[model samples]
Target: MMKTLICNMTTYMPKGYSTTPVLFYLIISSRHLEDIPLQAKKCRNSKVELVIVSNPEFIQELLPSAQRTALLYHLSYLCLAKFPKLERILRERATETQLLFGSSEALLLKCAATSQNLVSTLLPSLKAAVEKNKSVLAIKSLEKARVWINEIVDKVEQMVKRYDKHNHSVASCTSDVLNEKAETEKQIEQASKEVDALEKAVIGLNQELWNNNQEIGRIEATIARKNNELQNHIRESSNKNNGLSFMVCLIPFVGPLIKSIHQAQANQALAVKTQAISNELSQLSNEKSNLKNKEWNIHVRLTDMQLKLATMKLEKGSIPDPVHLNDVQTCLTRIQQILIQIKKFWEAVSIMLEALKDETFADEHFIDDCEMKETFLKTITTAQKHWRSFGEYCLSARGIFSLQTKDAYNFLETSPSSLSKEEWKRQYDAVIVKLNKICPEVCTPKETAAIA
Candidate 1:
């Protein structure tokens, strides 16, 4: 029946739960009251909850005197899970039977079991039980020690196998970690060298960029200077062309005026020559009048001499002398020839004066009015001033003047007659060309009119 009960309790026990409390309960109910006191002693030392013991008298009857004392002593030390009514009954029974009444075993068990350290409870109980029944307690102790020794041996074997497996895995993991660390160090070294090379290349490129910028600046300045020179050349060429154009337009109008001036000069020269001839003729007339007066005085003297000789002859009653009469005749013939030469010279002088007066009047009538003359002179003066100024400017700017221009200016300063008509015209054209080369504005019609 006890075997069947143990089997049924083990079968019905919950999985994964502790078997110590169940085994303790089964021991209290079994016919083995010898170990009941030891089991109760163990349960009092550790955390084990026990059911209330039934059939206390039956358990008491089964135990010998020494075990009975030990069981009552252990029961007195129960705490944590208590059955008050059952505990009271067990105490009363123990007192009446004198099993633990006033004994040191009962007193020492109570003191030890109630201590904070439970190991203090074990020695006292074992000593008391051994004193009471040495052979029985010794046999039971040896059996319990053998069973605990077998359990410890099995657990140690299992721990050794688990430790070996864990050590093997840790060694393989450590080797893999070391290999990975070596590869990472090699890659880091290569990356640092590449970074250094790139830095040097960047520095070289920056210096090249700076040099290129300086060269570009110099090129820009040179281009600007060349552009200024080109602009000046173009402006000078344009001015020269304009001046030539103006001179071409003016040549026709100036030609007739110049011809008139030359003709007027020629007429003035003729008038001067005519006045000289008239003065010479007046001197000749004065000389002829004086000679006539001398001839008349001679005629009067001859008449008076004839009258005197006739008077003397009448008084003397003789004819006049023949030598006196011959002298008088010679004087008369010389007077007549001198008078005819004077008359012929006066007639020639009158005809020459009349012809000169006609030619002078015609020349004066053909000349322009005073205002026109003034305007023409002013135009020439202003053109001369402008031409002179331009010539000076060209000399200052270019360091020299054209030979044609210098020669033209020198010719203009001299007498117009020094050059022939065609030669004068050529010099005038040369001056115009020079003026065009220097400044075109002075040759414009508006400027010419303003000067006039």
Candidate 2:
């Protein structure tokens, strides 16, 4: 609902009328200003000035008379103004003809009008004024509507700006993610190239390893044959010494003339054979020592390579890849097992050498004199210790080989042609050296003593 106060300027006094009469105004109510129609009959006799007072508070000011007079129409209020002040003024002017004339006028008007008769006098002028006010209100409503439309436009613009901001943020995030993905792909490609190069190197190494293994096998065979020969020579030399000792003792008891002739011939043959066996034993021993040194050097090299390979693997990453994790674990397990076996074998070698020391003392001739027995026992003990040490070295070599094998297997499974042949050969030689050192007696001959 809207409210406004309107003034009517058309109502006025006539030129001959000698009355200080203010125009009478009526408060009109309607649903809207435009809905109220002009009424010429309602205005003519009533001398009413119609002013639209939409503000309910101002309507009371227009009707200040003490008596409340009401005339009703369908959903409308028509008011006629009356007051005691105006009545007393009219009564004191006691002009009988004028009073009779006013009375006659009132009666004639009452007789002439029907109960529904409306004075149409106020319609033409009042309608025009109301129409003007309606136009003003219409223009005001249009202005407000324009302001509302502008506010909606502003809200829509803000919404568009916010959408653009969010879209930009999303685009930036996508670009960053794409860049990161590209970088990761580049890293993976680089890693793959390195792996390819490493594979080629490993392949060459493996071929070399095969050649070295063959060489080591041949060497082992040679050593075994040489050892067998040395063993046979040692046994023969020992028997010859015993025979000569027997000869010397027998000759001392026999007649000197006959004994000298027989003894000289027998001793000459025994000495020559003993000297040959002695030289062979010395040669074998020297070769054994040389081989042991070589083997030790190879072991050192192999260990260094293993350490390097392990470092490379560690450098790769902490999180085990799904592809390699299982292989790595299996290799580690085998390495552990090989180490355990090596340790057990080393202990067994120690125990066997200790038992062999006892066996060497079973010779009654060597253990006859207390000083000689002590000396012999010391020699045998030393020899056994050396042998045990050599066996231990072989065990160490075997353990290293197992670990290297694991590494090789890992490489081969992933890429067959990795290490160079020369590299593999070097590793293989190293393994052989360690093996030879671990069991020096197995690779060399025990020396034979020559009897004079």
For each candidate, how many residue pairs have backbone atoms clashing (under 3 Å)? Answer: 0, 37
**lDDT of all predictions:** 0.28, 0.29
On a 0 to 100 scale, what is the lDDT of residue 318 in model 2? 16
lDDT of 2 by residue, 20-138 (tens): 11111222222222322233112433332332111111111111110010100000000001222222222222122122223322322221221111112111222232334333332
- The parts of candidate 1 lying over 4 Å away from their true place are 1-125, 190-452
lDDT of 1: 0.28
Residue-level lDDT tens digits of model 1 in 170-269: 2333333345435434544333444445445545544554554444344333433432332232223223332211221111122222223323443455
Give the Å shift of residue 431 in candidate 2. 19
Highest-lDDT candidate: 2
lDDT: worst 10-residue window of model 1: 1-10
Q: How much RMSD separates candidate 2 from the native structure?
A: 66.3
What's the lDDT for residue 41 in model 1? Answer: 27
